[model samples]
Each structure stands twice: as structure tokens, then as C-alpha cells.
Target: MKHEIRFIINGESRSLTVLSQQTLLEVLREDLGLTSPKHGCSTGECGACSVLLNGEVVNSCMVLAAEVDGADILTVEGLATDDELHPLQKSFIDHHGVQCGYCASGMLISAKALLNRTSRPHEEEIREALVGNLCRCGAYADIIKSIQVASRARR
Candidate 1:
């Protein structure tokens, strides 16, 4: 059955008709054309489809589109404003944290969720927050450095 859902995405309100079985990741990428959330391991173990639902990090692949009705969603593409990138994005670039770029979006979103709640997180906390995200290129050192750099920038 198709159900109509209203949700806020990237600070914009939107209404979508989605199938009951469709995951939020599918709706966001295929239906809504928001492709920043990569389709990695669809099983939700990879965290490639991470997004913010009501300001909390979630695995979109594990969430149903119907479950997010009236919720606020934030994807990687929404991180920037105008032509400027988010501080985390800039820090990632400056720190050379992105390797293959496949995990970059999820990593950034996860980091944003952490930084949103805690301005200064310890290295262990940062690592714990990113436990679900998998970077095949082994750029964790740089990724952590990027988060630390962004934290300093925000101070």
C-alpha cells in the first residue's frame, strides 16, 4: 500500500507517497533524489546510509519511510549552506580524512551528531560514535583528526 508522509528534509518541508516496505534510504535517494547517502551494505551494518532523524543519527536503511512522518531529516547534502561547506566538511578536507569517499558522508553525519550534542568529545568518544561507520580505506586516523580539528574550530 502507498502511504502519504510529510517530513522536513534539509530544513524544507516535503510530502511524499511511499510504499510501506520502502526504507527511508530508498525514499531519500531514489524517490527524493537525495543521493549523498550512499547505498553500501543495505543490511544497516555499514552505516553508509546514515542520516539525522529529528536531530539524532539513524541508519536510514533500517528505518521505514512511513516511520518518519512529520519528522525532521537531515542528509549529507543538507550540511552545506549557500556555497560554503559545513565546518566538519572543511575539516575533513583539510585533514584529508576522505579516502574513497564512500564512507565520508556517513562519517560526517555521525560526527555532526556527536558534535551537536557534545562540542568537545574525547578521542575515544569520537571513535565510539563512529563505530558503526566502516571506512574500507582505513582513514580512521585522519577522520578522528578531522573531528578534533572541527572541534577546535568551533571553540
Candidate 2:
């Protein structure tokens, strides 16, 4: 069964027909061609397919496309403006937070969600926000540092 869903993706209004069983990850990558959210783990353990659903970080693989009707979604592609990259994105590159790059999008989304809630989140808060995301390259140190730097930069 296919259902039509209308949602805001990367600040753009989108309406598309999606299979009832299709995950948001599938709809984003396969249907919408938004490939930043990688399909790392279909079971949602790896956190490689994270996106902000109405400003909250969620595992895209675990969210059904049909469930996002009228919701606002934010992918990594939406983080940047025309003039410059989002502070977290710049900090990620400068701090070497992205080692293998597989987890970069998800990490960025999670960090963005954290920074959205707290302008100056503590180190422990950053860790808690990213607890669900897994960096296979073991880049947690750099990732944390990047978030810290971005947090300070935002203020």
C-alpha cells in the first residue's frame, strides 16, 4: 500500500507517495535522493541514518515515512546556509571529527539537535546527546571536541 505524505524536508515542502512499510531513510535516499543519511544499520543501532524530525534527533531507519506527515525534517544538507557552513560542520572538519565519514551526517544531526536545545552544552551533555551515534573510526574524542568548539562558536 502506498500513502501520500506531506512534510517539510530540509526546509522545503515535499509531498510524495511512499510505501506504507517504507522507512524514512528509504524515502529520503531512494525517493528524494537525499543521500547524506547513510544506511549503516537497518536496525537503528548504528545511528548512521539520523535526522532531525521536528528538531529532535531520530534514527531515520526506525521512523516510517508515513509517520512524518506534516512534520518538519532536517537532514545534514539543511544545516548550511548559502554563505557558510554550519558551525558544527566547520568544527567537524577543523577538529578531524569525521574519520571514515560514514557517521558524519548522523553525528552532525545529533550535534545540531543538542546545540538547538542548549547553546552551551556541557561535555557530559554532548556525550549524552550522541550516545546513540556510533563512530566506527573511534573518533569520539574529536567529535566531542568539535561539538564543544561549535557550542562556543555559537555563543
Candidate 3:
């Protein structure tokens, strides 16, 4: 069965037909061609498929595409605007937060969400925000630093 749904994606309004069981990750990668949200673990354990669903970080793989009607979604692809990288993106690059790059998108989205709530989050808060994301390359230090720098810059 297919259902037509409308939602805002990356600041743009979008409408599409989705299957009841199709995960939002599938709709974004397969149908919409948005690939920043990586496919790591199909389970919600890995935050590799993270996205901002209505401004809250969530695992896209765990969300039903048909359930997003009238929702606003933001992927890592939406982080940049007009050829300029977001502060987190720049901080990540400068701080070497990304190594294998598999978990970068999710980490960035989580950091963005955290920074959205608290611009100058403490180290503990940054760590807590990224607890859901796992970096295989052991880049947690750099990732935490990146978020910290970006958070400070947001002030």
C-alpha cells in the first residue's frame, strides 16, 4: 500500500508517495537521493542514519516515512547553504572531527540539535548529546572538540 504525504525537507516543501513500512532513511536515500545519512546499522543503535525530524535528532532508519506527514525534516545535506558550510561543518574540518566519515553526518546533526538548544554547551553536555553516535575511528575527542568549538561560535 502507498500513501501520499507532504513534508518540508531542507527548507523546501515536498510531497511523495511512500509505503507504510518504508523507513524515512529509505525515502531520503532511495527516493529523494539524499545520501548524507549513511546506512550503518539498520537498528537504532548506530546514529549513522540520523536526521532532524522537526528539529529533533532522530534515527531515520527507525522512523516510518509514511508517518512524516506535515513534518519538517533536515538532513546533513541541508547543513550548508549558498556554498557556505555551517559552523559545525567548518569546526569539524578544522578540528579533524571526521576520520572515516561514516558517522560524521549523524554526529553533526546531533551536535546541531544540541547547539540549537544550548549554544554554549558544557563538555559533559556535548558528550551526552553524542552518546548515541559511535565513531569507529575513535574520533570522539575531535568530534567533542568540534561540537564545543561550534557551540562557542554560536554565541
Candidate 4:
């Protein structure tokens, strides 16, 4: 069945038709052309499909597009404004947290969620927040450091 979903996408109001069984990842990539959320593990084990749903980090693959009606959605594309990267994005680049770029979007989103709740999170807290995410390239140290750097930059 098709359902009408109304939500704020990347800071803009949007309305779209989504199948009841369609994952938000599918809707975002197939319907909306937002390609950052990778289709790594469709089972939600991999954080490659992470996105900010109503300001919370969630695996897009685990959520139905019809479930987010009237909610706010923010993908990696929304992190920057007018060609300027978000502090976390800049920190990721500077700290070499991104490698191969497959997991970058999800990692960035997870880090953003962490930074939003605790602007100055400690190493442990950062690790805990990002526990759900996995980087196959072994960039965990740099990812953690990037979060720390962004946290300090926000101070």
C-alpha cells in the first residue's frame, strides 16, 4: 500500500508517497535522491545507513518511511550551509576520520547527534555514542578524535 508521508527534509517541507514496507533508506535514496545514506547492511547491523530522525540518530534501514510522517529528517547533506561544512564535517576531514567514504555519512551523523546532546563529551561518552557505528577501514581512533576535536571547537 502507498502512504502519504509529510516531513521536513533537509530543512524543507516535503511530501511524498511511500510504500508501507519501504525503509526510510530506500525512500531517501530512491525517491528523494539523497544518496549519502549507504545501503551497507539492510539489517541495521552496520551504521552505514544512519540519519538524524527528529534530532536522534537512527538507522534508516530499520525505520519505515511511513513511520516518520510529520517528523524532521536530516541527512548528511543538511549538515552544511552555503558550501560551508559543519564543524564536525570539517573536523572529520582534518582528523582523517573518513576513509573510502562508504561509512562517512553515517559516522558523521552519529557524531553530530553526540555533539548535539553533549557539546563537550569525553572520550568514553563519544565512544559510547558511536558504539552503534562501525568502520571497516579501522578508522575508529581518528573518528573518536574528530568528535573530540569538534567538541573542543564548539567550546
TM-score, every prediction: 0.98, 0.98, 0.98, 0.97
lDDT of 4 by residue, 14-110 (tens): 9999999999999999999999999998877889999999999999999999999999999999999997999999999999998888988999999
The C-alpha stretches of model 1 lying farther than 4 A from their native spots are none
What is the RMSD, in Å, between candidate 4 and the native fold over all Cα?
Answer: 0.8
- Structural RMSD, model 3: 0.7
lDDT of 2 by residue, 1-155 (tens): 98989999999999999998999999999999999999997887989999999988999999999999999999998999998999999999999999999999999999999988899999999999999999989999999999999999887
- Give the clash count for model 1: 0
Candidate lDDT (C-alpha), each:
0.95, 0.94, 0.94, 0.92
Clashes of 4: 0
Two-way lDDT contest, 3 vs 4, winner: 3
lDDT of 1 by residue, 121-145 (tens): 9999999999999999999999999
